[model samples]
Target: MTNYHDPIKHLNFLRQTLSLDKKPIGFFVSAGCPLSVEMPKGEWPLIPDVAGLTQYATQELGSKDEEPYNDYDRLLKEVVKSEKDPKNIEDILSFIRSLKVVAVGNDVRGFNIDALSEIEKNICEKIVEKLDVDLPSENSPYHKLAHWISIDRSVPVEIFTTNYDLLMEQAFEDISIPYFDGFIGSRQSFFDLRAVEDDLMPDHWTRLWKIHGSINWFQKENKDVFRTTRTDEINSSHLIYPSHLKYDQSRKMPYLALIDKLSKFIRKPNSLMIMTGYSFNDEHLNDTILNALKSNPNTMVIAMLFGDLTYKDDNGDVIENYPNAVKLARNRSNLAIWGKDEAIIGTVRGHWHTMDDDFDDSINLANSITFVQKEGEDGEETDEKIYSLNLGDFSKLGEFLQALIGYNQTNFDEN
Candidate 1:
């Protein structure tokens, strides 16, 4: 039996869903969103991707014989000795925090309490410095997303992101779009789990939940966490949740509550969650999303991937696959992986096809799906043809959204 994905039908369904949806619609933005920001010369990103950030951190924290920070290299080696991904900053930071929590007054992993704390400090500082970037201008992708949300709709869009950067915040402010992020107050906005649980805010005001915490978040001496805009007011470590990667600390406040919101959002009847820029590397989030799918059949999770979801081996067997998402999609009909070269929908994996032979958007589907002259290994154009749907890229998704709303698409690049 041959199964194929009809791109036109799927796109029409998506457009219809967006047009007449009265229920909840969410956009799960992740780390890859920031990789779209290019420098002035357009050489590299203003903020590096996770892989690039990890490499940068490793180099920045490397041992310098001239300096006294040799302990960072030693600590990193010990923490990541058996880790499959040795350069993962989140895992490294998690291990450091776990060690610090148990290292009380003694040496753990050959490092004393003081040494471990210093290493943790160095890593956190580097992460904050690298992620603290301003959006190039109001015309950028983030602002496009904000404009999409700013448009009047029956249900205000809910944006749930795992990124710590302030790009989203900047965009929202630039457009004067009001949003709530689990905090309440006119002064120092303090985290109010009760408000988040009660869900009293108006639907017009968008909901922006940073499940992994943000760089501007700070904890005071009184154990109260607040959001601050002034760097001088940042007194301590940024309240990030990579520490919750620990089993013992998984139920900590704020992190646990924010994650719960995601589960709640998906459980709503007739809901849609469009995921972009996520690598699906975090097992905890993956488990949460999968569990929510089981609990609610009405909710749909559209996981758009930046690459192929699966590929065939030399023998023509589909041996390679996105293990987590593919395995989950095999059983769940509500879950869909709209990948670059392929897609997994309704428990079937295959390339994209269109029922319409005279496809009007064959140049691409909705300014997102691109029809390419398939290139060979040498990068030369081949006789073969292929289709690539890249709504997974934040920029493309933004463009798609603008076109969907019939907004200012012509002047999108002017700024």
Candidate 2:
């Protein structure tokens, strides 16, 4: 029970490796996990959770008695079964968008663009509305993350999020932290590919790239992208429409430049990345990380998964029983993964492994003491001083960041 609930060992390992002088470390945030966690009553439903999205999807598809609605429902089920990822909203949006395209010019007879677009708009609206909510005063992980980045005044942190929500931006704003989002000017924020690709971007300025288009983005008559707070109507939004086609669309201007930055950043020596909330659902993004691991031996990724890891079988069916990251870590010595209480740490040898099946070899985060003690020693107190750590809560971003900050602070005091 303690193993599943504790994260101190992993946090300490992270603290030891982190340095302000190392190559820029990036944070990759996704829609699940952090966003899915319920906020306090006053801040309840700050972002759309999985259950809400599921209900929204069901409602959008309508009743099973309706043939068209049933067809859409079947489509969603098929994609889920094929991908073996339950939180795969991108695939669903992509299929609907494709159907709309094929429905043009007698390309398809049954699909309706208006209907599909309606559902897409509904989901996007909810995201935008909730994202714009006021920031809560609680121990927000985003604030802690920003605080961590703020500590290294010499270099700014790079944050890349797949979510369209403004949660990160809001956190930064609330804390008065400055960030560049590839948009130039103030009155009207427009896409600036030049600024994003600029080699002269100051190291002290944090960089945020939303690889997936945000809900505020809309293309005008001149084809120029504009940001707006108007969520009343968004059927014609310029957002890439939350689809797998994002990979293809990503080849275009703004997205292409942003993704290229990620690729180049990770390829640098000593580069480290903390990837959270992502479910490895985006193949393109996963490919980038895998390439980095292969090309940059010094690069490391601490991928934290909130749910069970999954991998594909020989028949290409997703197998949920195995820890996907653990298997991947075994093959790549530069990667470490933490999910719930389980973790696979990289080894001195050219392999990845855990302390043991029971995790006795790992440090106990509570008091920095392991359950495994001297074999012959009776239950007696040792004279050695043991550094203890208290993780107020576990398995949440706030707790993780708190532990990390505390560990770093301890080191600072000792030095």
Candidate 3:
């Protein structure tokens, strides 16, 4: 029987085999869930001024008074109708746009936080409350991983996130982990001067690529700057709100060049991409990932599926083919799927204080080791566990990163 229960042993074995120090791994975070806290309305908290306007609108619409706009279905319609003049309509629409509700995709339509309506804000507030109850801060995982990787790897790790929030930056600052984002160095420069200069490669500093514009990212005076703290003195033009492709256009040449850089980085050989909490909904983003896989077939993708792996077919029947969904099937061999149940099992005790204690981390570790061994045995019955764990338990985040680093090191050294 293959003894897969010992995580330390498994990690050490993999590290010895892969020589992980030679090649670096890349992390791509999907803003929806894995690294992001899901807000009910899909809305991120903007600067205080914008937030105040939103609160005012919500309160004026009877949200604070708990009065229905007009029953339930007609609430939004009534509000729109209340603005008889075109200017009033424009003002309302502008306020609605300022709320930055478009950030939430179509998937959350039925939820109370659907779009950027008052209902959505209320829902998001509740979620935030729940989150506050469990974790002291959102930067917990980011800081932990950043610190761990910095100490373990020779090369600074690269983090690419599609989120528009400052959570990641906040985490880095809280931990005092220095990071170099594509933004922040220059405002008016059309090209990434940092990319051209060797100074960009500062020693022991992580590269944080915000693929999408951040909440604090704004263009002004023909330049872009990302600010984390609030500032009322800044001009209205300097406020970076959640926007669509237009935001990308606003960056002009710099944004395009950054995307190209990211594309090249992802295509590197022996590179492992760890994706968490992304739904693979954005076609353009998906294309980038697909292209990366094509460029390097040997690349490994470890995806954490928060829920079941099943998807419905066109006929509305649930299908067993999970990780095999059309968009993901192309690189099936390198794909690893972890669900919620499995996450609890795979997590390390005391590493994450938020997860339920009832779940067996040891059993999950044993199972994962067994699954890897079984895959290597060509279907032969080995004393290894073949079951995979779920990806729900947040604590598993640390363990996953650790295992991945170990696995990469082992594979690198063996080759």
- Which one is best on TM-score? 1
- TM-score sort, best first: 1, 2, 3
Per-prediction count of colliding residue pairs? Answer: 0, 0, 20
Q: Which lDDT tens digits does candidate 2 get at residues 218-284?
A: 6654556666665443335446545444323422566677778888778877777887776665668
Residue ranges of candidate 2 with Cα displaced over 4 Å: 1-10, 36-38, 41-45, 60-87, 112-119, 126-132, 230-235, 238-240, 244-251, 307-323, 347-397, 403-415
Q: Give TM-scores for every candidate, taking all chains together and pairing residue i with residue i.
A: 0.89, 0.73, 0.57
lDDT of each structure? 0.79, 0.60, 0.47
TM for candidate 2 is 0.73
lDDT digits (tens) for residues 53-157 of candidate 1: 878888888875655657777776776585636578888888887787788888887888888868777777888898887988787888888887887766878
Where does the lowest 10-residue lDDT sum fall in candidate 1? 406-415
Model 3 lDDT per residue over 1-415, tens place: 2212333343343335234675666666654343333233545322222224334434544333434433223334444565522223223433344333444554332323334555434423332232222223544555546655655566667777765556566667776788777644333323354562333766577778766544454455545444433444334332322223333344534445456656766676767666675656555666766677667767666555555556588999976533333336434445444443232112221111112223354334422322232444476756543343433333355545444443443334436
In TM-score terms, candidate 1 sits at 0.89
Report how far residue 293 has shifted in candidate 1, in Å.
0.4
In model 3, the runs with Cα more than 4 Å from the true position are: 1-19, 34-139, 184-193, 196-199, 223-230, 237-250, 311-316, 319-326, 330-337, 340-386, 391-394, 402-414
* Model 1: CA > 4 A from native: 65-69, 243-251, 310-321, 361-365, 373-385, 407-415
| Quality of model 1 by C-alpha lDDT | 0.79
